[model samples]
Target: MTGALKVGIGGWTYEPWRDNFYPAKWPHKRELEYASRHVTAIEINGTYYSTFKPASWAGWRETVPDDFVFAVKASRYCTNRKVLAEAGESVARFVGQGLVELGPKLGPILWQFMATKRFEPDDMRAFLALLPAGEAGVKLRHAVQVRHDSFACGEFVEMARAAGVAVVYADSADYPAIADVTGPFVYARLELAEEANPHGYTDAALDRWAEAARLWAAGGRPEGLPYVEAAPPPNQPRDTFMFFINGAKLRAPAGAQALLARLNAPA
Candidate 1:
């Protein structure tokens, strides 16, 4: 496959979206269905706070369209540990908690470290090594979100690339925005959305981000983003996942839809 581009929101279940994104009088049970139809993918935020049962995973898989995908955020127990290496069992358990049930609909599993968590080379390397290539004969993709500035080095990018794991490109002032492409795919979190804009981002901003995503999909780094390396590789194809999160939370779904349309529209 050349690669696919997914644009979506952080989650589908939000009360605020009822009056804004979702249709009035819509059933809660149908939220996923409606949201999935509007966006190509969604970042499952619930998984970050807690684990779910196999039946739940299966039901979620059945709720959306065949082309819809979900990127799960790993639980805090696995990534927010005092010792990263010791989180092996937690990681294993989290994966075992029925992620495979999502089947073909499962996208990348995101591991987000806390803002206070610095990058310790050995510890980070050990943790990355512990991440499985696949589970139950199903291949899995992974992305890491390190909030520390220490992760902006070439070593971190090299290590992640060697493990075939992507480093999440978070667009926010609070976190260290690292744009290093370290894997076959790219994971991005656009956190600059504003509540004032019902569409999440202005048209000019959307245009800029759409162009940036195009470059990334073509295996080139986008300008105006900080990078560990000066130059990117040739135009090799890569799958891309872009999410509108942690900013203007209420307008996120609208922003996701806008970006999705932009990505799918004619050049």
Candidate 2:
């Protein structure tokens, strides 16, 4: 379960998820199952954009293997704006059924806020109050990927620690603050498709990251570790979900394989 952390792909790497490979060409169910065969984890972006039915969850559970994990995005309607003040029942349902239902396969419910947004200390308070308290018997991670840089202040950490939530170190165009924090719980959303279409983390980049991961593996608690990846596009990163990296959509399977190879390769 723990070998240099796990690697994953976004569920709908391309719009109409079935489209990246070919909307009109490939079978729907087969593509996901095929993808699952390689990577053990996937980020579920759809849950954020839309709600899901129990049948869908059951079907998804059946599709993914026991070892596979699903990281879901907290519904945008609930977290993006200042709606946490009204998270109420609808939001609870979204988190409980969508996130908790995944059982052990659930990784983290990533609450990714929009860029223009800011964390009014009050908003953070409302958010924590609304979030599911997590399982009494388990320790599931809850991460917040704040887009605006303001949340990076020390006050945010206080908020996270107060709620026992993990602050996600998201790789995006915003303030690189995501990779600059630490806490009891940790989540890192490595984004690749943002910078140069492809991060091209030369040997130097890979080497540096490798060293850091090695250090983390060896027992060092740095803020957030940078994972190499590409962000979707300005037009749609989360819309595609996970593998929004540059030069690697139709070829996402290849990209995941490559990253693993690099991770496993001896320094």
Candidate 3:
């Protein structure tokens, strides 16, 4: 990549991704700033699992640096449904509060949807339409992480491009080939298995990622198709996120760090 490669731990709250060593007993609120010292970013998991007060969010914003960014998971109300919900005041309230509150600090809202056996273009269309209608005319990074195997086809890519959304690239057990991932917006949900993926940063993988990143940086950023990564490090150091998705506990974040190292290495 021409510009600096954005690199960071996957998250901050969890134990294995962080440390209880220096923290005072049980309460550890100022973790984001601490994590930023060693890493560049993190996916905000707390927003997904539970609601946060404005004060809590403000505290988080205050903790991080200017360059550090946060990728927030869209709440259950938005992503859990097969079809997009109607445009209601409550929906506006949920989105508006977040958009207004998070402001520039928010990296991308990862809209991770439930898996379907078959691709439903209608469902995808509805979801795209339902997204906050321009978030009060302000554009912040946004992306969709669809989990169905059927969503990996050329049709799916075309649909996303037409709608100005991104189909996330992921490593999972459901797809025929994880190697099939290809798209403009690169929201890479990298699942790390040390033995399964030795070293994680293969030369070919680095080359592909580097090219994509370079292209994305050179004014090729897809609208609402923000690229994101959610891989925790393998050894679990440096406050990476550990999400337990579909019974697979993505362990420590060493792999993600390696990815960052590779991506940022001298071109």
How close is every model to the real structure, measured as TM-score? Answer: 0.97, 0.75, 0.71
Off by over 4 Å in 1: none
Ranking by lDDT: 1, 2, 3
Best of the candidates, lDDT = 1
Write model 2 residue lDDT over 127-174, tens digit each, in one string: 777777575344466777777767766677767767867677655554
Candidate 2 to truth, TM: 0.75
- What's the residue-level lDDT of 103 in candidate 1? 96
Better of 1 and 2 by TM-score: 1
Stretches of candidate 2 above 4 Å error? 1-4, 13-26, 135-139, 181-185, 194-203, 217-219, 222-252
Number of the predicted model whose TM-score against the real structure is largest? 1
- Least well predicted 10-residue stretch by lDDT in candidate 1: 228-237
lDDT of 3 by residue, 128-220 (tens): 666653575556555677766676566666666666554555545554222222332335565533434433445575455545555443423
For residue 96, give model 1's deviation from the true position in Å: 0.7
| Top-down TM-score ranking | 1, 2, 3
lDDT of 1 by residue, 19-116 (tens): 56889989998999999999889999999888899999999999999988999999999999878999999989999899999999999999999999
Error of 1 at 65 (Å): 0.6
